[model samples]
Target chain A: MTIEYASIEQFYELIEPGLNSVELAVYAASITTFFALILVLYKRLHHDKLNTLPVNISGFGYAIPGTVLAMAMLATFGPLDNLINEWALSLNIEEPGLILSGTVFAIIFAFVVRFSAIANGTISGGVEQVAHSLDLAPLSLGMGSIKGIFKVHLPLLKSSIFVAWLLVFVEAMKELPAVLILRPFNYDTLSTQIYQLISDEQLEQGALGAISIVVFGLLPIIWLNKNEEKS
Target chain B: MTHLIDIQQLAVKLQNKTILSDVSLSLEAGDILGLVGPSGCGKTTLLNTIAGFIEQSAGKIVIDEKMQIDLTNLVAPEERNVGMIFQDYALFPHLTIRENIGFGLFNLDKATCNSRVTELMSLLKLTELAERYPHQLSGGQQQRVAIARALAPQPKIILLDEPFSNIDARLRNELMIEIRQLLKSLNMTAIFVTHNKDEVFTFADKVAVMSEGRILQFGSPVLVSQQPNSWQVADFLQLGSWIPVKCNGDSAETAIGSLTDVHTENCQTGKTESSIMSLLVKPQHIRIENNENVNVEINHVGITEQGYHYIVSSLNRTDLSFDRLSFYSHDVFQLGQQLAFEIIHHEYLMFDQAPPR
Candidate 1:
């Protein structure tokens, strides 16, 4: 088969899915990293051995393959969605069909579960580098714990949080298995669109999308290398 | 006047191990209490307990005569109105100096907060560095910012954990004096922890010597230095050398000399049956004799600001012999030189050979 360059119109056609992928990745990474930061702070400051169990559990998700995680999400949320629908039917109300299993929420949930370990590891290491006294100093100054975290810790953790977000975003952009399995019907991310083009033997058409994904993936590596050199 | 801070029977147990036990202390307003001890002796633990950073497993803490903290009625650190300066100063690296000092002033009006920040900046001589982050400043400057932040909220009491440990030795004393004057001017009651006894003498109005999770003695710096009540206190303070003494009837024999009327008044061994006691012999209590048997050989010599300091070991190879006998003199002494010395006739102070079990 001849490998002809795709027309500019075909490249422009991929922008919508590319933007959608960026948007989804941003939301999932932000939410996951925020919770990861809170979990880290709680584990460090509370000194509770039990708190570490949840952190360990969150990190265990990374060990699971993305395809397996997507399947697990479907297996878990499908039943819960059916139970909700059954309850609505019994009450003579309109059933929200496939609310979770057939929506973007499933894909986002799969991404969060898959990438939470990265966020947790990066953020927790950052928090550990901070002196424990930083936690107590604000408290001693009559600042409540929540406010102190936002004012004192979050500022100190800016670089770590940014790195975590970037890592998760890159991973989500490159992730095809989970997105292909869990993405809602009629919704297409860059990864899914590229997978479709490659499946249909239109490599030239998907080359632009493929390059965008690779470029996004290189962001965190470049940023991390720069930081390592600085330090 | 009511005590600004009162800790009664405070005990802290971490991970099933007792860190501090039955610790009690009281400080009136404007009082500076120094907690001095060896490493792992729980001085910093006591300071953290008082600051509400560590929960007391037993007893209660009263701050400003109103807030009482106990196991049943727990108060968070922020609500305790206690401020702290950590060993590393714990200054926020993200915030500028002005923002750091103004951190706790968030509850106040904007004008009041700005005014307080400005006031603390001027007071701490941080006005010029107000825009700089913690990493941009020197160690002393960071410490001043930490102090300013702690003082911004006008806390009921201040707790400092090894505040001067990170400071340059040359600047430590000067910083301590300046901070002491600032605390006194504000009439802010404070407790500071340090392993260095000299810091206590230079910085604290009262000194509490601690060992094994207990304050062995507490009093004015001079009193504690001159008349430590326990063997641990004297040994930890390096107040003097311990000379082994054996008591017989109304007299005691030492490696140095014998003393008549070795009554129980000056004896604090707490063990009546044990005849072996250790005498707390100060360096000034010893005098060189012109004609006598050489009883001590100089083992170590160093120059102090006052004069030459020598640590000599006993030449008499007997049960009563001891090492690390320290004294100072203007006359030079060789490292291996043997000398004759006698304990001057004075009030005798004796303690147990070891801490009371």
Candidate 2:
């Protein structure tokens, strides 16, 4: 058998479809925003009950296997997708079918379900590192609870939030099993494209895509090491 | 009108354990109250409850006799117009000194806020360090920034938790005096907690001694030292060593010698069989006698600014075992040196001893 890929340009050309996909960008942004909002809401609404069930359950996703999470997402959203499509057909909306499960929504939903724990854990740990007295300081200084969080806690957690976002972004970029199961037809993120190339025994063509995933995955490790040095 | 902070029967229970119980105290508008107690004695809990960090389970906390907080309806810390200086300073490490001080002044106009920050910085001697972060400042400077931040909003009351504990012991007194002057100049009503009783004398106008979630006594520092209401207060403050005595009506007989004019204010008035009582023997009240018989042996000795001080224990164990009396003089005494001393003429502060083992 002949190896078709000969140069870096060829590898780039083969993986360009995955790199330039708007759906992948949208999925990454969607998961990041969704996780951040959930983490902040958890902190604001139930700060006193941080160790309670609600917060712990929200962070439990980190321990879940990606394949199991993908299947769980499918089991929940697939039926809901059908119910929505049937309603749309009855309402005479032109061509509605499998809206959530058939598009990038499925992949984004799966990503959020699987990776939210990373963001929540990082942000929670950051919040914990701040002296509880600092939170009370703003309140004693004439700031309300919400205002105190915004003025004091958020500013202090800025670095943690950035690190959380970067970690989730990189993880999403390189995650394979979940995206492979949840991604709709013709939707190819870097991980999904590289996986398909390997499955087809054409890994040489997707070398640049695989290298990119490895490079992206190294960011969080480097960041954690730097933080370890700091502390 | 007599009180600015009127806490009536305030109680706080956490996780089924009572942290503060019926902690009733009041402070005048310009008075500073110092809370002193051993570790885990609920002093910090009381301060936190007043600062609105911990919710009270019962009773009421009234501010200026108008705003009252109780079990059912609680005022948030911000709306209560209270301020706090945490022990660690908690100076918003990410913000510069100016920003931290000006944080609470956000409600003011920009120019007004700037002027207020400038005034406070100069008053606190933090002007030169305005642009520096908290980590860069020395401990004392960070403390000043924390004070400025707490004072920025001009709250009716402020709470401080062991603010001087982090300072060098040598500089602690100087800083305490400076901060006391600043608070007095501002006419700020405040409550501070410290385990060190001496701090109450140097920093506070009033002292409240607490033990096991209860206030044992609340009075002027001098008053508390002179007359601690309970054994816990006397022991915690270390007002004087206890010399066991046999009570006989108004007077008591001690190891040093039989003494008249013993005050039994805390005991029953009527006569009864001789019972054990503890006589408060301060160092100043003991006089060294130049006599043939040395009645006591030096147990310990230490040098002080006034002179060398010695703790002398009774030589005869049956008279009173392990009972120590302190004596201070310019004359240096040798360790284990036998000394004869007599109790000088003074009114005694005596309390009944717990039943013997």
Task: Say which candidate scores most in DockQ.
Answer: 1
Model 2 stretches with alpha carbons more than 4 Å out: A1-4, A7-16, A20-51, A89-95, A219-231, B266-268, B271-273, B354-357
Cα deviation of A34, candidate 1, in Å: 2.3
Report the C-alpha lDDT of model 2 over B1-357, residue by residue, as the tens digit: 579899999999998899999899999988999999999999999999999888899989999888889877898778888889999998898889999999999789999999999999999999999999999988888899999999999988999999999999998999999999999999999999999988999999999999889999999999999877777788888777788777777666677677776556644474433777677778788888899677789979898886887888898677555446776899878899988778888767777653122
Model 2 has a DockQ score of 0.82
Q: Each model's number of backbone clashes?
A: 0, 0
lDDT tens digits by residue: candidate 1, A83-108: 99999999999999999999989988
Highest-scoring model, lDDT: 1
Which regions of candidate 1 are displaced past 4 Å?
A1-4, A219-231, B264-274, B354-357
List the TM values for chain B, per candidate.
0.95, 0.95
lDDT of 1 at B38: 88
TM-scores, one per candidate: 0.94, 0.92
RMSD values for the candidates in order, in angstroms, are 2.5, 3.0
Model 1 residue A162 lDDT?
90
* Tens-digit lDDT string for candidate 2 (A1-231): 124456756556646555634346446645654556456546654547453555556667778888998888889888998888788888888657777777777777776766777777777777778886787788878888788777787788877777777777777777778877877777677777767777898867666677767766786679778987997
Clashing pairs in 1: none
